[model samples]
Target: MNNIELLKSSMINIVENKYSFKNNGLFQTDIPNLDFYFSSEPTEFNAIIYEPSLCIILQGSKAVGFGEELYSYDYSKYLLSSTHVPAKVKILEASEEVPYASLRIKFELEDIYDVIKNIDTNKLAMNVKSEKGLFFDDLTEKLYEPVSRLIKLIDKTKEEMDYLAPLIIKEILFILINDKSGYFLNKFAMEGTVSNKIVHAITEIKENFNEKLNVKELARLIDMSESSLYQNFKTITSMSPIQFQKKIRLEEAKLMLLNQNVEASEVAFAVGYESPSQFSREYSRMFGMSPKAHAIYLREEVS
Candidate 1:
C-alpha cells in the first residue's frame, strides 16, 4: 500500500479498537480537544460550530459547507478551519463494511500564533489567497507522521501525553503553516489583519445572533470601517453580515427544535424573530418545510 493507504489502515485500527461498538457517532478520546467519529450512514447538512482545527478522514469522505461553498476532503487531504465559524456538515459516504472514520484536533488560535512566532515569518510564502474560514490542503507524508504520532499517544500515560502531545500538536500546526496554506493561516492568526478582524466580526455575530445586529457597531469593535468590514467579511464568509446572522440563527433554531421539545413559535422568539408568521415563512424557505414538519422529517431520518 502507498503511504496514505497505510495511514488509513492504521487510523481505522486505532479508532475501531479504542471505541466500543454499542453505537456509531462521535467518540471523545482521552486526548484533550481531540476526538474520533465512526459512522455507517450518510446525513443531511447538520449545523455546527466549526472550531479552528485540523480534520483528517481516514476512511470515508466528508464535506462541510461554509456559507454557500461546500469543501470536501478525504484520505488525501486535510480540512482546516482557520477561524471558528458556523458551518453545516454532511457525511457524504459511509457503510457498515466501510464506515466513515475520521479524527479532529481542535487547537486554539494562540497555539497557531505561537507556532508561527517560532518559525521565521519571512520564510513563509506570502502570495497565497486568503480563502474562507475553512479550506482544504493536500495531506503530505510530513504532515501525516506527526498526526499519526499524536494519535499513538492516546493510549499512553497522562504524564507522557501532557509533555509530548502538545509538542506534536505544535509540530502538526507548524507543518501546515509552512505549506501553501500558511499565508491564509498566518493572516487570520495575527491581530489587525483584515482576516483577523473579520473573524472577530464572525465571533460577535455568533455570540449574539439573537440580538439585533448593528453592523457599524460590529465594525467599530473590530476596528474596521463598515464598507471594509462588509467587503472583507463577505470575502471570507461568502455572505453579508445580515445574511450570515440569519443563517446562524436559523441553524441554532433548528438545533434547538431537534433537541428540545418546544413550539416553532417559541423557537422563533428565542432565536430573535419578532413575528411567528415571518419566522415560519423564513424557516420554511430555508429548510423546505415548516418547523414542525422539518422536525418530523429529521426524526424519521434517524429512525
Candidate 2:
C-alpha cells in the first residue's frame, strides 16, 4: 500500500488498541504539543477561539469556518490556522462504528519566526495578502509523510520522543512555509503587519471578554482607523468586533455553567451582562436553551 494508506491504517490501530476510544472526546496525548479528537456522530458548528495549529483528519471529514465562509476537508487535505481567530468547527462525517478521528499540533507564534527567518526571501514574498487567518490546502504526499511520522512518535518513550517530536513538527512547519499557506503564516508572524495587529486586537478582546467592546479604543490599540479595524476584523474573523465579543462572552458562560454549579444570573453578571434578563435572552437565543435550563441539563448529563 502507499504511504498515505499505511498512515491511516496504523492510526486507526493505535487509537483503538492504545487509547481504547477513551471518552469519545478530545484526547490530550502524552506529547505536549499534540492532541487527538474523536466524535461518534455528526455535530453542529461549535464556536471556539481556534488556536494556532495544524489539524489533519485521519478517519473522517470536517469543516472550519466563520460567517459565510466555510472550508471543508477530509484526509486528502489539511487545515492550518496561523493565529487565534473566532471560528466554528463541525464534524461533517462520523458514526459509532468508524468515528471521526483527527490530530492537532499546536505551535506558538514565536515558534514560527525561527523558520520564517531562514526561508528563501523569494518564496516568502509569494502570498503577502493574508486577509484571513485560516486556510485549507491540498495535502500532498510531501506533507503527509511528516504527519504520518508524527502519528508514529506517539508510541515512543518520553525521552526519545521529546527529542524527535519537535524536529518532525518543524519539518512539517517548514513544508507549509514553503507552500501557499506560508503567505498566511508569514503575514501573521511578521511584526507590524495588519494581520498581526488584528491578532493583538483579538488578544485584547479575548483577555477582557467581560468588558464592553469599544471599537474606537480597539482600533487605536492596534494603530488602525475605526473603519479599517471594523472592516478587517469582520474580514478575518467572519464577524464584526462586537459579534466576536458576544460569542466569547456566551461561550465562556456556557463553559462555566457546565463545569461549575454557579447560578445563571451570577454567570450573566460576571460575564459583563448588566441585566440578567438580557443575558438570559441572548444566551438562550445562541444556545437554544435558557441558561438555568442548560445548567440543569448539564447536571443531568453528568449524573
Tell me the whole-model lDDT of each prediction, alpha carbons only.
0.83, 0.83
Cα deviation of 37 in candidate 2 (Å)? 1.3
> Residue 167 of model 1: what lDDT?
93
Candidate 1 backbone overlaps, count:
0
Per-residue lDDT for 104-130 in model 2, tens only?
A: 899988888778889774666544343
Give the residue spans of candidate 1 off by over 4 A: 20-22, 44-49, 63-71, 86-89, 127-130, 157-163, 296-303
Q: List the residue pairs that clash in candidate 2.
A: none
Give me the runs in candidate 2 sitting further than 4 Å from their true place: 125-130, 299-303
| Residue 256 lDDT (model 1) | 88
